[model samples]
Target: MDERHDPARARWAVAGLFFIVGIVISTWFTRIPQFKTGLSLSDAELTVALLAPTVGALTGMQFAGRLTARYGSAPIARVTIVLAPAALLIPAASGDLVTAFVGLLVFGVVDGIADVAANAQGVAVERQLRRPVLSGMHAAWGIGAIIGALSGGAAIATGLTVLQHFAVMAAVTVVLALVAGSQLLPAGVDRSQTDRESPKRTSWRTGWTRRVLALGLLGGAAMLCEGAISNWSAVFLHDELAATAAVASLGYSVFTVVETATRLVGDGVRRRVGPVPVVRVSVALAIAGLALVLLGSPSDIVWLAIVGFGLLGAGLAVLNPIVFSAVGHGSVQDTGSADTAGAAIAHYTTMSYGGVLAGPAIVGWLSGAMGLTAALACLLVPLVGIGLFARVTAAAEPAVAD
Candidate 1:
């Protein structure tokens, strides 16, 4: 291996990529209200616009595995990361629903591809290190999200326009992506060659087996909860709860801050207690957190809702990382080839992104019909589903290097 592919350096570089993704996503999420106002969209119309990204992400995930296999994860990630920030400018500058929809669609496709590539890099690094570091890498994402949310909230308070905030964020993201991307591992490790050399090779069909699908489902459940909160908590606070824009943004800030704090210690916990138990406990905590929000909503107690959001964030912090790590660690039996892992990851990402696609629209439609309170309370359903499927992660074992 090249000195540049040193596990330590690669780990930090991948963390940096994850951090940049987090920043761009959080920056856009924090400005959802601004987008809504700028377009003068109804809740239903906003739901329709949000669906654009979901569609783009699903479309991108279909091709991400092939792209990663053909060109390597690094180059694909580098291009997408640079493109992602630029795409943000589209929606931020949009003065109508059509433009916002188009902008979000482009941004979502780039973001979806970048997401899989970055996680593929993280999985590769973890396999090299032969330890649990995925949780910690994901923590960097939480840290970036916290910073983005706080900065965006402050910018809104100080009279910054959507274009101004997005432009600065985009420039910062592009610079960081180029610098960090240079440190990623070089791409040419072929799975076919590895399979020829190994004692056994997993068939491609193994990547879509029941166990893998179950793990993907668990991951999807987590993403759905996270997506809903990221896209709606601020809206819930600002509009439904009648909070000022600054205070509304704090809901997301508090959530990400607590989530980040949990992730700081998540790796240690995973190594100690193992992934299954951690997931079960996380699901339980998430249920409790959402219950608090449900309880608070009825009483108009903003503080309670804020605290609940914090707990929800903490519960969700480790889930996707754990699922991704499980996939990298040969969670699917006989599926340890590099290509198999990449394919499995693409499948997992597709399922997870489905949740993201459904979340905003579900919240929007339900909130429009019943009420935001009832809409949010519905998150409890999926949290329970996660607990039921927690055992799937236990099947994973460390990858056997080719």
Candidate 2:
């Protein structure tokens, strides 16, 4: 096969960008302690500082679609990946809290834009290949996170300064960007044929129709489940379930391991059964898992909660992929809008971030009021919502009764 223009090559290129973003994010957060010490930020200040990326990311997402439609997924993805690691260096070398905030904010902006572009490029490759590759691409991100964490630890253990560590990572990312840029899709590949002549002003109505936002709600709900598990699993295990400290740590590791492994093979499952069945089953599994987590409290079996957490990871492994891919494929049509698929992808992604923000806070607030298990149990409602909305990701929409 001539590899230069092969869709597989393009797929790998996009996947590399996803991997790069993952590594950039994981590296930054893993080294956050250094920022705290170096910048001498108070606890409250640190919490506020941590929010910079989320705010920046949301702001960037608003522009991602227009940027992609104007240029293309490849150019934007390539530019962002190259900038992402360098953005990390901002915080790494920041001399004050304000500077660190600015650095992280920039990093988040790059991250938000790169996310939509890379995924749009991946969807384009999947269209060319006529199969599901998004799952594996996402799985690549999970793998990159593991590698980033390990490498970040290695950098710390070897006594490298934060700036030096980030600089090396940035250098490596720039070098890899050359290879990714060479093979990623061309500038107009993911854009619509009519997009070039369409009026440049994109009103929110373009892709923010009912269905896309509905899909966003579904995606957001799933992400809330994820955020809960990732942040609260350990706390739930140790504090609520009376598990050992070592056991508590295992909860998230198990969730991550299972989630990544499931994603590696999830594309095949989606291909075999179709997305609707996959999503329905996924939500059921997540609900079942959360149920087990709740049951562990009454039965006092911590292992059930552990297994439940793994199931939650496995269940959610491909949901966001399915939601994003569905939007990219235009499976759900809406009112007439000239928005490119990239724009639509960017639109729903904002809601996804909203879920990420709400999850931990909702859980914590409920934990304080009703208790931890009950707070987690509340996730069931959204899990059910996911299953109910599974058809949004399917090829055919149910006909409306006039």
Candidate 2, residues 1-402: lDDT per residue as tens digits? 356757889888878887887788888878889878888889999998899999889988988888877777888887888998999888888888889899989988999998988887877777667778798899889988988999999999999988999999999978988798889867666654565677455545456656677889999999988998889999999998888899999889989999999999988998898889999999988888888888898556999899999999999999988888877766224423223778888988888888988999999999999999899999998998899878878842121211
Off by over 4 Å in 1: 29-51, 89-104, 150-168, 189-206, 231-250, 300-302, 331-333, 363-375
Q: Rate the local accuracy (lDDT) of all candidates.
A: 0.81, 0.83
Off by over 4 Å in 2: 1-3, 192-199, 298-300, 331-339, 396-402
Clash pairs, model 2 backbone? none
Q: lDDT per residue, candidate 1, 92-120, as tens digits? A: 89888899999999988988888888888
- In terms of lDDT, model 1 sits at 0.81
Best by TM-score: 2
Candidate 2: Cα lDDT at 362 = 96
Q: What are the root-mean-square deviations of the candidates from the true structure over C-alphas?
A: 4.5, 3.5
What would the TM-score be for candidate 2 when compared with the true structure?
A: 0.94
